[model samples]
Target: MRVALLILAVVVGSVIFNFTTPFHLGQIASNWGLIDVTIWITFVLCGLAFIILGILMAWWIYTYQYQPGQLAEYEPEDPVLEGRLTILTTIGVVVMLAPGLIAWNDYIAVPEDAIELEVFSEQWTWSFRLPGEDGIFGYAHNKNIDIIANPMGIRDDDPYAQDDLVIETNIVKVPVDKKIKVLLRSKDVLHDFWVPEIRAKMDSVPGMVTYFWFEPTRTGVFEILCAELCGSSHHAMRGEMHIVTREEYQLWLDDQITWAERKAGVVPLTPVQQLGQTVARDNGCFACHNTTGAAGTPGPTWKGMWGTEVELDDGSIVTRDEAYVRESITNPGAKLVKGFSNTMLQLSDDVTTEDIDALIEYLKTTTPAVE
Candidate 1:
């Protein structure tokens, strides 16, 4: 009797927790609410099975109380009972699997009118590219990846590569209520693009491009997390995506620089800026930070950064002096700058003390002296 009662208590507690617990899916911000439906369907089917079996076990325990004079009856096989159990199992399986099959069918069907963009993942950062006025993407090759002209490996001679808009920062912006198809490409190991609120995710495999589409139904900031473990900094590989009004998105898009402008040497680099730029590119600093503009890079921009008192994400302020710059370059993970991540890979043997000094000198020249 005690055993049966204990089993009953477990079942009741589990069911109560399921219904009363505050833990549930967050608010759906995308059109893929069907994914949620599929998940719930699976939970319900499995949960019902668990509860029913538990209750049946408890009932049998209660019914078959031990008796000193009672002899146990052995029934090797019950064809009728077995048949009923088999049929019930089949029904339950079908009920659980049908929704997933249906959801997958809808998952691949991207709308024809969806806007197209490319998302590129590296060791620990996310970058993006969107088709320019041409509305077409050019060919790309790993061999052509240049630290200077084309960091994204867009073939310079290819006409289509000319006007591609590059967003080196991981903060993606999309218009609300529009289907957006994102092409996933990876330069290094495996990575997965996932946004919990959007309920859409896809693996970014190297040597190939994978894609998925979703319509943003709400306007808010959503986090971009790497669902797959890529490397040591996998946990720190985070980004932001803002869903906003159409007008706001367009305005933001217009402010971005195009490939042609970047390639044409339009933003002429000063000798000091040029040296710093070369050092940064060669050392893969631009992989997380940008030097061309004021703000876009996952790491803070190099433009106007020097001689300015900067505030960190932790609400701490530090002057970008020689000492701070030295510490930041050699031991990048040592400081946590506001609005940026500590995912910066450490550079010890690769970067010497002299190289750091050169980089500091170049960085100082990137920003002009304030009058």
Candidate 2:
């Protein structure tokens, strides 16, 4: 009965391990390079140890079979065996810990020449500010986002921030083989900036700045996702990062700053229009909805949408005139487009009537330029 029970236990254990261990083990191994290798080594060592113990136990059970006059021999603990086990366990611990210590050291050490980038999280979008040619970022504030003053809140007094680039889009570009330090902060709620390829992640908490550094070894686009759930759009919160050659990255940064300046110069219908653009951005509308007539997007194109004919949820189509646009902006579910989900938030409290009108006017004139 005891032998049968032991066999049953082994079978159950094998079944459970076979079914559940691979996925979680693979996930952990893929995430941490050092841990991944260490885990395999540990697995091999543990497997060997379990096999050795199992063989010895089986031998003891077979040899001491209770058949009539059969007798069991008892063996005392050996000091040499204890010492050997101690040494083996120590070696295993060192093997496991060495790589972890090295990885931690590398993680903490920031290169002197690393580029500093500030990432601001608000609502559901990420805004990035890269240092200018001066290798310094100027003091910035949301209040100074006004047109007359330094647009984008770049402090004029700070010489370093004079030429800094501010990007509102979801795409981030960085030079290959260069160390980067990202400073993260949140405007509203807690958010986490994570990129798996670089093995770098950091939290963005409200009213505080957190930082992480990494160097990209590969030149390709990687996904940037919010590791922490923020709100209703948590699952849909995603962005992209472009890792490119040094020359390309420099050109890209220069173009971004120039584009931001040009955009600041273009006058909107009203101050509220300007504010609406900022609010629309902060609310993550640009992720799925494109101002440009981009292809393969999830929602309706905003370009020339203000005055176009839009189909409604009730099998009725209507011209996107002022009142219709206003209704769409304030209450998106009131007239849901057939192909799009009714996921748009009601801007009744966050946005004013004047703001919606200005945004509509801005939408009428501004169209995204194809790259």
Candidate 3:
């Protein structure tokens, strides 16, 4: 009796706690109520099953308690009881699974007027691309990826790629109340694009494209998180989704340069800066850092930041001198940067002293006066 009573108390407490502190999903802006309904249905049905099974167990223990000289009766199987259980189980399962199937069907059937946007994921960052005036996407492949010149690897020869607009920053803006068909791709390993409030997520597998669609009901900023672990700097992979008015969205979109314009917009680099650019690309420096001074990058920006004072993780201030740069490259963890992880690997012996000097010169050219 004590054991049964204890179990009953636990079951009742759990149900009460769940009801009192129900999950609060803040500001759902998409058509994801179906998902919520499915979750609630499953939770209720499972809770009911647990209660019934627990009560049955407690009742049997109390009713069939061991008594002195009590005869033990063994009955193999009862066909009627089994039949009733099977029917009830089938009914419960159908009730739980039917809603999920319906939600899934709705998820895949994207609207015909939905705007197509491509999101490319890397080891620790995200980049986006949108179709230009033609209203069509250009062909892109990993083979054509040149981290410096052509990051998205839109084939230069392809006419469709000339006008494609690429955004290198983590923030992407979309129009409110518009159906957005998100197309996902990965440059390297596997990655998942997830926006919690929007209730849309899909895996970006290398060498293939995966997609999903959602329509924002309101205008607001939402955070984008990498749901899959990609590498050492996986935790730093974050982005922002800005849903705004149609006019504002168009203004932001128009400001972004097309692939052809980006190619032609490069400023002439000095010989030293040119060499530094080559060395930086060879060392994969741009993977963690950006030249555009964009925030949310894994590493600090290298553009026009020379001769500036930076605070280290240990509360020490250091000047951005040649020695500091060299030491950082040789022994990456010696002085950690505040608010950033030390995911950099020490340079190998193959990175000669001359290469280091050229990189330093390139960084100098990025200073305010020189730039």
Compose the digit string of candidate 1's lDDT tens values, residues 215-318: 99999999999999999999989998899999878866775678888886554333344345446767788787765765767788877788889888778899
- Pitting candidate 1 against candidate 2, the one with the higher lDDT is 1
Q: By descending TM-score, how would the candidates be arranged? A: 1, 3, 2
Give candidate 3 misplaced runs (Cα > 4 Å): 265-371
Query: Candidate 3 lDDT, tens digit per residue, 65-135?
Result: 88999987999999999999999999989998999899888888889999999999998999899999998
Q: What's the CA error at residue 6 for candidate 1, in Å?
A: 4.4
What TM-score goes with each of the models?
0.68, 0.50, 0.67
Worst ten in a row by lDDT for model 2: 23-32
Best by TM-score: 1
* lDDT of candidate 2 over 143-197, digit per residue (tens): 5455444434555566666567777666778888788888886767889998766
Candidate No. with top lDDT: 3
Q: What C-alpha lDDT does candidate 1 achieve relative to the native structure?
A: 0.84
